[model samples]
Target: MPILQPIGRTLLIFFAAAGRLSMFAANGLSHCVRPPLYFRLIARQMIDIGYYSLPVVGLTAIFTGMVLALQSYTGFARFAAESAIPNVVVISITRELGPVLAGLMVAGRVGAAMAAEIGTMRVTEQIDALDTLATNPFKYLVAPRLIAGITTLPILVFIADIIGVFGGYVVSIYKLGFNPTTYLKNTVDFVQTEDVVSGLVKAAVFGFLITLMGCYHGYNSKGGAQGVGAATTNAVVSASILILCCNYFITEMFFAR
Candidate 1:
């Protein structure tokens, strides 16, 4: 009975947390559709989530693509299947690596920032002050971030796909001694619109999860500065984990035969 108690308690806590998150998400998304929309705040969040994140996302994508190309060449060469390198690189990047890498990078950067900022506001009573001021904090803070995340991540992933594919092209042509024209043709011929679209969809979902986890953790934070730090860490870790988990489910939905 004692051992069963611990398992039961853990399950209870998990379900409670899940319920709270679902409610938080529903409230935030409901506010997103309501009136008094803050375009300015949304725009600011867009720049923060998208433009400011470009350098890290781009660099990660390029390096991932390059390493993937090199690794694929090494593996495929052993089987005299080196000609398939471009196809693999293009398909892998457009379908998985670009979105996943970009989402993880942004989760580390933007998710932590959102949690820290909001958790500070929570600890300092700023969020309560907004309530006194007749301003809905969810609309003003969470909605903008959520909207920006959903709208911007697809664009980020799209640009990442291009840069990633280009990186593969450079590595395959220069380091792997592959002909540029053949590699380009193979890449173009192999990639389908569904692959790119599926990746963008995953990016949008990941963006939403990142911002939502950050906001939820921060908004519910306690214990002052220490809580803020914990929330920030939780935001990044939870968002990254969710991105990976959701990526698999989304991929299954899109491509599983």
Candidate 2:
């Protein structure tokens, strides 16, 4: 009975947290649909989430592609399957690496920021002030972020796909001594629209999860500085975990023969 009690308590807490998150998500999404939409706030979030994030995401994608090409070549060389490197690189970048890596990078950078900012507002009573001032915090705060996240991550991942593929191209041709023309041909011929589309879909889902986690943690945060800090950490960690978990489910949905 004692052991069962602990297990039951854990399950209860889990369900409670899930329920709260669902409620928060519902409210945020509802606000997103019905609104005197804040285009200016959404635009600012877009710049913060997408444009400012480009350099880090681009660098990560390029280096990832280069490393993947090199590693694939090494593995395939044993079987003299080097010709498959280009196909492997392109398919990998478009189907998995680009979206997943970009999602993680953005989660770390943007999720933490969102949590910290909102948590600060929460702890400082600014959110309460919004209520007093007749401003709907959900619409003003959460919806714009949600909109920007959903809209921008796909664009970021698309650019990452290009940069990643280019990285592999550079490595294959310059470092591996492969014929540039043949590598490009294989890459072009092997990759399909579905691959890129699937990645973009994953990006959108990831974006939503990231913003959702950040907003949920921050909005619910209590205490003062310590609580805000904890929220920031939880936001990043939760978003990253959700990104990986969703990546698997999304991939299975898209490619599960």
Candidate 3:
């Protein structure tokens, strides 16, 4: 009977999870369709998640671009192709590394924070309290975060692209002795609008994934501290995994054979 109970409980939890996710998706769609939008909350979240996160994202992008340039210069120099460094750096940053790294960083910072806050609210029944006060938790709690993520991530990614390109520029010019003008010219000529657009699109998708996973896990947390901790961990893990998987699909959409 004890063993049977465990299995039954597991099945019940799985079904609950599926139902919760479906409901969340439906509610999100409904809120988006309805009027009386919550712009203030969304703005606040944008400041918190997007603006505050800029320093870390910018720093990461700069260092990544610098390292990529350095490494590529070494390898390409071996083939007597050092002139390709600018093009390589630009393409790599704009297409792949910028969006992916920014998404990963936000997953660690914003995703975990969202999950913990919402999970704690759940455990304390504050979400229920909102309902009791005739407030919609979906509108009040979830909408802001989702909208902020969607709006602000692209901006952040844009900044990251600039910083990353400059990082590569510094590495190429100073360390590798490439002419700055030539390097900049090669980068400008090699990159396309499509490359930048593709990365921004990926950033938006990643933002949505990060917020969705955080809200889903946190809103459904159970028990007490242990459950909240689990939700936070799950939020980060799921957001990171989804970001990577979605990157492939988005890349295919942009550049598939």
TM-score of each: 0.98, 0.99, 0.93
Angstrom error of the Cα, residue 239, model 1: value is: 0.7
Error of 3 at 224 (Å): 1.2
Off by over 4 Å in 3: 1-19
RMSD of 1: 0.8
Q: What are the lDDT figures for the candidates, one per model?
A: 0.95, 0.96, 0.92
lDDT head-to-head 1 vs 3, winner: 1
Please report, as a residue range, the 10-residue window in candidate 2 with the lowest summed lDDT.
211-220
Report the lDDT of model 3 for residue 71: 97
The pairs that clash in candidate 1 are none
Misplaced by over 4 Å in model 1 are none
lDDT at 136, model 2: 97
> Which candidate ranks first by lDDT, i.e. highest?
2
Kindly list the per-residue Cα lDDT of model 1 for residues 1-257, writing each as its tens digit. Answer: 79899999999999999999999999999999999899999999999999999999999999999999999988988999999988898899989999999999999999999999999999999999999999999999899999999999999999999999999999998998989999999999989999999999999999999999999999999999999999999999999999999999999999999
Report the lDDT tens digits of candidate 2 across residue range 1-257. Answer: 79899999999999999999999999999999995999999999999999999999999999999999999999999999999999999899999999999999999999999999999999999999999999999999999999999999999999999999999999999999999899999999999999999999999999999998888999989999999999999999999999999999999999999
Alpha carbon lDDT at 97, candidate 2: 98
2 or 3, greater by TM-score: 2
